[model samples]
Target: MASNNTASALEKEQIFGLAEKEMEYRVELFNKLTHTCFNKCIEKKYKESELNMSENSCIDRCVSKYWQVTNLVGQLLGTNRPPV
Candidate 1:
């Protein structure tokens, strides 16, 4: 029926809208994380083409700690469903 079709179309549109929002949120979060870790772990000057061992370790630790804190806050808020 036309009504059913209209409802189905609306439902799909909403689902797609939600998916788009999730993607945007993820991209924004990634950008923030990258900026934070790079600033904290790497020097302001670009002295090397590749990260040194210490720089690599610092980034790893920074990301690990970021996620740990994220998880903790998520748990505290009861929103700690596994990542989508």
Candidate 2:
């Protein structure tokens, strides 16, 4: 029916809007985490230091682990669920 189609279309739009908002929020969080983690994992005084292999490796692993933690926490908070 035309009314059913209209309702479905509206629902899809609402879902899409929510998804967009969630994506924006995730991008913001990622940017913040990258900035904070970079400060914590790297030394300002060693800016001129060529990529110390060990430091680079540590930073890479820390970022990966932090991302995993963020995802787990986000899942626990039901971030993927629709708002009431």
Candidate 3:
């Protein structure tokens, strides 16, 4: 029926909107994580063109902790549902 079709289309639109929002949220999360971790782990004094071993280890720990906190917060907020 036309009404059913309309309802389905509306649902599809809503799903698409949610997906878009999710993508935006993920991008923002990534940007913030990048900035925060880089600032926290990487030294301002650029002694080398590439990361040294200590910097690399610091970055690894920073990223792991960031994800852990993110996941914990997501779980607390009940928004950590497996993606559809």
TM-score per candidate: 0.90, 0.64, 0.83
lDDT of 2 by residue, 33-77 (tens): 778668867777776648677668878987887778777776888
Point out where model 1 deviates above 4 Å.
Answer: 81-84
The count of residue-pair clashes in candidate 1 stands at 0
Q: Per-residue alpha-carbon lDDT of model 1 for 1-84, expressed as tens digits? A: 999999999999999999998888788777877999999999988899999999999999999988787777778778843232
lDDT of 1 at 44: 89
lDDT of each: 0.85, 0.77, 0.86
Local lDDT at 48 for model 2: 65
- Write model 3 residue lDDT over 28-62, tens digit each, in one string: 88888899989998898899999999999999999
Off by over 4 Å in 2: 71-84
Candidate 3 regions with alpha-carbon error over 4 angstroms:
81-84
Q: Which stretch of 10 consecutive residues in model 3 shows the poorest summed lDDT?
A: 75-84
**Distance from true position, residue 32, model 3, in Å?**
1.1
Question: Residue 18 of model 1: what lDDT?
Answer: 91
